[model samples]
Target chain A: MTIATATMTSKQRMLAALDGRLPDRLPVTTHHLMPYFLDKYMNGITDQAFFDYFDMDAYVWTVPHRHDPSQGEYPDPEQGEIGFLESRRVSTDDWRVYWEKLPGYEYQTVRYRFVTPKGTLSMVIQSNEHTAWVAEYLIKNKRDIDLLGEYMTAPKCDVEAVNRTAEEFGERGLVRGHICCFDVFGQPGCWQDAACLMKVEDLIYATYDDPEWVHELLKILQRRKMIYIQSLQGARFDIHELGGGSASSTVISPKIFEKFVAPYDKELIAAAHHAGQRITYHTCGGMMPLLELIADMGPDAMETFTPPGMGADVNLAEAKRRIGDRVCMIGGFDQFHYLIDCAPEDTRAEVRRCFEEAGANGRYILSPSDHFFDADPELIRAFADEARRCSYR
Target chain B: MTDLEDLRQSIIEGDMKSTTSLVESALADGLEPGTILNDGMIAAMTEVGRRFEEGEYFVPEMLIAARAMQAGLKILKPKLVDSGTKPLGTVAIGTVKGDLHDIGKSLVAMMLEGAGFEIMDLGVDVPPEKFVEAIRGGAQVIAMSALLTTTMPNMRATVEAVKQAGLRDQSVIVIGGAPVTQAYANEIGADAYAPDASAAVRVTRSLIS
Candidate 1:
């Protein structure tokens, strides 16, 4: 076993591991910025601090869009600040965003109003942790689906902009680019995309009434994503994420997954690998049932391994025993109670348990099964500190 | 043909046509509505819940079974209404403020209704006051669902509001979602937490019982 200090760059270590090569030590990483931590203590620190403070591998997100300002509609807010960054509520079309500052919390609430054909919906958020999710959108009915089919514009790719971001991130850490979902209402492809464009309740009705129309809508979203993947030609992303757990084996029956999900992602993942990129399956729910199925879909890594006690039956030992060699296992820590205000001893013990279960194999990285909100500082320190104690021989 | 054995067989086979037809035939045959409900529909739902928990069934299966149960209820409800068949309890449910996800909430409501609890679905973006009103309207349980960590505090506030209304003891508080856990449930002063829809049925039954 090598006892190493922080000498190798984060990118070198992460890439080495991804290539099935050994690094100096295990690459400790995190999935997201903890909203509670940043708002309360950090006082609005930079996004870079998420990796810097923890001394973990950095995951840089690059979103490249080539928007035609003329074709794109911009709202000039009547009340608050007005800029591309600033927003206001439009009564008619529902796509609106505005920010408000609270007294104690460092972040501001960004409220978004989405006006869809079925009804109007709104979401208020104070942090990225709770970034407003949309419930309804303009594409609610069958005719609205037809409208999106006819008029929805393809997002032009800004390859140079994305490559510039990647160049900057490559010097410090790993640069990861993601596909922008159409709207926050649903999946970027397949059943979830259909659910989001149309309401879930309404979609259920549609599935029975007009199965063929639903199939056409899924095909359109799937095709758009295929075109986007083709655009990712020279972007230097280590891994691109695809497929939400809502389509995982746990959320839907194998029938629905095979019927709607597999047919779509199989094409995409094959396309991505063909384009020389690895895929990460982000299943934030029970994955035990779908582990084999997900592995079959060919994601390079699986994340958010919800512990058995926490709804999803994630037996880390069994997971590693089953599919650890096939792909990297991204998360296993029981963040629900163990990370928040828990005993330091308990936190340390939990970390060791994950290590014993998953770390023995070569493809495990420690992370919270999912993101957590506010947590005790001592527990946070304990997690980082205990993870460092696990050595790779 | 409208007997409990026949109805149970139809449901087990997922013969929605036969199940719907049986309910109509039972009503036409002057069979007791309560018997068709407690003996037939609820029994099928119970079997569905058990199979779901045991992993013998999945979401689509549960959804289809819930659809069949609702169909049976459509036939049985009016007859039960005339015969004065009362529900086991009432539950007020919604996805809390700031969270737009509803698949989890919708599944829980279906499972609760399948268990014979009348559901007062307050829809999504439900503020604290809406929960208070639902409780005041004779809901025995106040259930909050949130898919994000940001909206979790809304669950706590709803629980506190019910307490402020002096209805906390009279009403049991429950919360569930992709991000929710038992520890969060306790920290937020909720009486119970169910990770999934099947467990939700069991948890609600345990709470009200």
Candidate 2:
């Protein structure tokens, strides 16, 4: 019997898809909503169309906070640049939310750059809308590390606010959340946090010059994230992304990953799962060397199966055959060459190739291997349109 | 007698303190500055590069080894200059515009410095015009790095701008990064492509030699 035609919220569809259940069709999701799309497409398209255009499940993120409702300039803050957003100044006893609005959408960049006895640190503004995340400082020296460890506060997440937002999104779409990441910086987990808090350059040096100190810093960052994940209990989320792939395999040797990355991330993943969140590990670059290791750590899904041509050397078919049963695969589209200036037919063919390789086990999400900065808008429609055609059901 | 072998071991073990001490001792013991650099320091770094390529060592190992080599060079550079040791060539390096990523470029710069080339790092988010300025400043080879594909085209643009300014032949262009390829280098009319920092040094040495 044919199912009755009815509207499903993006949250409902996405959770169903994550559970390996069929939606009306394939659920196409992006890592982030691009500002370029929002600025150009002003046709009264609601945020839901951000996913609806692709016919994919929509995921809404709401980062909540309770701060003092007052207006004043932050004298000295922790992490990011202050006065650049809509921030109200509060006494030390009160809390505040800092936000900066740009044209379009329900999102704004919220940040408060803090100055401490050690040094300065900043927090990325979390919102329902997509804002560009940028790094304000990279750990450049040992002094910077000491300062970060001493000064940077583990972010205070408003779980009550998040629960309310999730309840609001109930059955409409999926509510997805991640560990509040450092402002326009690296990934949210410990290793990436360390990489961001400390510049990749300085971190490399510290690995040899003072490994013990590095371990301590990573532990602090890891513990902070664990606390955040634990706090995520009972919150509505489909899957939370935790790792950046740059350090996973090709960027650094597996030895470094073993010493610096794997142990901590593996720990975080376990904690997140214990807290009832499905984990999606995002390795944007060459992850072939560490795929088995990453898979063994047991994230529910993995993304951006980069091809060797793109400097991420995963053969999609090989990756699927090897670990397809173990974890859900996301992102196999080639956005670099295929999306920009390629023929529409070529785009269709690429989509078919991804489907054939990753679509076999009913455990893949077809998406661009990573975010595309510039693309022909028609190319995007071809991607979404083709994905719609290749439904598993 | 602090000899080449001892210095080589110092570098190989990444004994920066020893490497520094050995270089001074070698200079005091009347070893020729060029001999110490080529036979001792350079030889050790070349082995480090080989071990890195062979996967016997990783980035941390390579970084420390490079750091140790730098410590040795700090002693050797002034002596070589006083003794009139000419470098292989001059290199100007930078990340392409719109790309702020620089670990790759900085590593390439360090490796080039280790290989005895005078290097001018143009820093990140470098426009094509900055490359032109670097070339006019007497850079013999221009090396461009880009971590993002969106910025990779700037390498080609920089090369074309150099040609337009009539400076292409005077400076060889080399490009390398996570996103760049030898094929990309050829397509963009670059003179060379190095897959990694160690190879970057090798290619730079060959171009100048």
Candidate 3:
């Protein structure tokens, strides 16, 4: 195959790689445009501005969730600026929602309680300027899983809302979203979603202490996700994210992934394909061991090929050799060190390395291994410039 | 199988019910608590660690085996104390200040507990003063974890606080997490750097020894 002489737009570049064809140049992008990074580092520039400043391909993430009116779902009243398609309140008279602000912390702490006719479930999330984390998981006890099954509202795709955003976005970028998980707290994979509800440690322990219970809980979560996937028919998303860090080999073994992660996600991927949307399995850690399994899940793309320097065991050349033909490879550059502390020349070299390895195949998009809270704008400029220079011949 | 072998097998299989019952039965049969713990609980955890290192077991497997061992240990703890037994060592573990991630820290704590070390887990977003306090309170080893690159400098701050508090020699400092490395550990003056939970246990044991 010979390199094209003509240049492609950012959308064309990304869509070309997603379709397993080489664009005029490498499609270079970053994973997330963190609000904190924008506010602190770039003086609150818009995401489009950041992409334009760096001259990189942009990914516009717009998550539009639909709720059943019969289920008494309503939009959250106190949604913030960063809240894109924030979770809706599903509890009616039978299930009440309550909130409280915990006192005394550097960050804001909010505890949300869901009072059900059966029982009550609560989750404590702590948020600083950067992001939020679950201090206390939602599913405190096994019975809470039953409460979620009974009371939780299943989110559907708001096809009109998504189409409007896609129209506004025009040909600027790819419109990305994810399949719905649980409300307020969830992951794309079934086991990973369960882990968020129950803390990861508790869930892992539960897998051994009560394997049957674990399987039952995973199935419950899987059913909820299937409902959401079924609702995705005709949504105008370019690609949907379908996995999380928990399924990565750095977190779980390939054995656990095959047993717990693959089966449910495979079904979800098939559902997504039926809905006329492409899926990308987002594993932000080690992918070396489970590359084939992730490819077998039938996602159009795979991402965050974390390098060993970031405490993950990913080799981009080997990953490209093993599974690049099967799926479009998305991330491999080491932004943790190279994008922040290194020289611009060094950053360019790393970009070239990723291109040489994963870019030879027509199905690769050069991206940071994951989100970077801090990076030199000059280095980012060099990165994009180097990626643009990496043309096929 | 003999009762001890049965107990070990239960723990290895992550059968908490059988492991706890077998421990109680062994104790009722006048078996030595130390022998039961060493031969059954610790031995099973050791095998789990070996399997984890060999990639035969994963995080879920290790976590379940640890849970089974904890259940058996609950039954054997008071007996071991009454029989004048002591833990291998005391280690203080926590995620550093400004970092809220704790999966790695919790894994290290659980693994150290499985290896017979008493762990004082100062949960996420722990400050430098907390490490000094843990050291002053007789924690012989300090294990710090941070998942974010921005929060990684806190490891150096924690090590400096240990030195400034004159507890540097009294406690061995170890660090691990996604962005932490052996070179970073050395740069931060940490005594050791563990790549994962299993390695954390081994490093903690060697440090305390």
Candidate 4:
């Protein structure tokens, strides 16, 4: 009933669906075009070209940020070219990094020491060409968080920089960024950022063993993210994503989500709206249990509804029936099966299936269930082509 | 009798302080270490697993409960050793090479340890040769996990390396993680595929037994 008669630009289509309205067709896009995919398969095509090649509804991401220079902050001198989602190491005199490349490891392992006045906090990390993960967490001791909360510099959003990019890009695609994260490696959501600093198992145990300490840690992270959100007076972002997979039901219980995840993020979601921006709560794991819970947070949209086959529990039809009316739905196609080692027909069928189930009353953007590191280009074309043909009329 | 029941409830509720206290009390009351373990810790993990499979519990709950069980087990382990108790089997577990996602692998290791298996945890980003080393060092089973399809290939590579090392028959290989499936297990020629950590305990028991 909300479908328009004519075709709309990607921005207009996304904005319309984001408002719970339908456009001429489904708004199809992929999340994070992996550099590995672009380098290996497409001869290092630009991310925008990846969108054009598949004809997807594109989102141009921008994160222009700065650190406090008065604190002797500068980019790490010894660091090399930054990879995806990595900013230059924001170094200060109190927060210096000493990296030692350890011998004998399967992947690239580097042990980092952040020297500060209270003492030193160290974390080891490993990375292949594709992704990175924390090996040794920074907050080793219970009170190590004090070093971070006291010394860590929160990145400032360059409002003029964001506004300039939006002006230049015009309507080619929607401009986006996320709530600022913890310094070294973190997600936007407060609890998820805490999970990154502490191992998830330890964090979950703390939620039971020392709930007050868990709150203390989450509060510090929540306050840092709030500093970034409050600075965004007019950033011109089409939608900013909040939440992460650690809060998903597959990883944590509903009780924990209600107790730890929802309260902190609910306030941020409101603050983002107050800044004249739209927010999409991104939980790229089992969303079935937290559907109504996340929806009640009042995000403008929600996403990455990972299916059960991918080891998360998302019943797309049931999800639409439950919260489809409340928020814009994005991402439900299983890229693992349909976009890799499958026929183009399979990909097209999945696009149609998502359209039938969640796209019926509109406000649904058909995307891959979540991010994928490997997939076929032909299947991707079929994915986009079929999505374009899925008319709401 | 009441103390053991309280110990079980503590473990089920993931009460670390009370689980250790109850185990200590049960030991002081002249209960056998094996009896305390079987009646208190393992029984509680069994209920935790049941609740996990039935959707009444989740990863965090399972983790907290496992922590409680481990806490109780720590109190019982020395006494159990003095009483000449033997673990069910030896399990060598890790997240496969190029995959640093270890939370799921850690859960499986803890669950297997709770099930009375002696575990040699190889940690994350583990190469196939380390698993081979564990087997040659007399680990009875090799369990590997990977959370990404990019890294899932390492599972098969590990299976191949075990065959190459001429120790394929010495160890039973169990593969699992987010992107892993039963078909992938079969494709990679692994002995078993467990959907989650709770199922992993049963699968590990069935395979080793």
Point to the candidate with the largest TM-score: 4
Using lDDT as the yardstick, the better of models 1 and 4 is 4
How far is B132's C-alpha from truth in model 4 (Å)?
2.2
lDDT of 2 by residue, A1-393 (tens): 222343445555455556666555555666665654445553535566666665555667554422322432232243243322212122232222233444552345455444554455455433332233333454544555565554443443556777887777666666666665553454665777777665676777777778898898888778757766777777667677778745756556676777888888888889888988888888877676677877887788888798766666778999998888888888878877677768999988898888888877467787788766566667778877777676545
Model 2: CA > 4 A from native: A1-27, A40-47, A65-113, A116-152, A163-173, A183-186, A391-393, B1-6, B9-13
Per-residue lDDT of A167-200 in model 3, one digit per residue for the tens?
A: 8987777898877766676778888788788777
The ten-residue window of minimal lDDT in model 1 chain A covers A83-92
All candidates' lDDT scores? 0.71, 0.72, 0.84, 0.86
Q: lDDT for model 3, on a 0 to 1 scale?
A: 0.84
At residue A208, candidate 4 shows an lDDT of 79
> How high is the DockQ of candidate 1?
0.42
lDDT of 1 by residue, B52-112 (tens): 8888887767776777777788778888889999998999999997666787888889878
**TM-score for each of the candidates:** 0.84, 0.83, 0.93, 0.94
Q: Lowest lDDT 10-mer window, candidate 4 chain A?
A: A1-10
Best candidate per lDDT, number? Answer: 4
Candidate 4's residue-wise lDDT over B1-209, tens digit each? 44788998998988889899888889888999988888778888889999999999998888988888998898889999999998988999999988878889999999998888999999987889999999998899999998998989999999999999999988999988877889999998999999899999999999999
Please give the lDDT score at residue A108 for candidate 2.
Answer: 51
**Residue-level lDDT tens digits of model 1 in A169-224:** 77566776554455333444456666555555555555555668767887778776
TM-score of chain A of 4: 0.94
DockQ for each of the predicted structures, in order? Answer: 0.42, 0.41, 0.67, 0.71
Candidate 3 segments whose C-alpha is farther than 4 A from its true place = A1-6, A68-96, A115-119, B1-6, B25-32
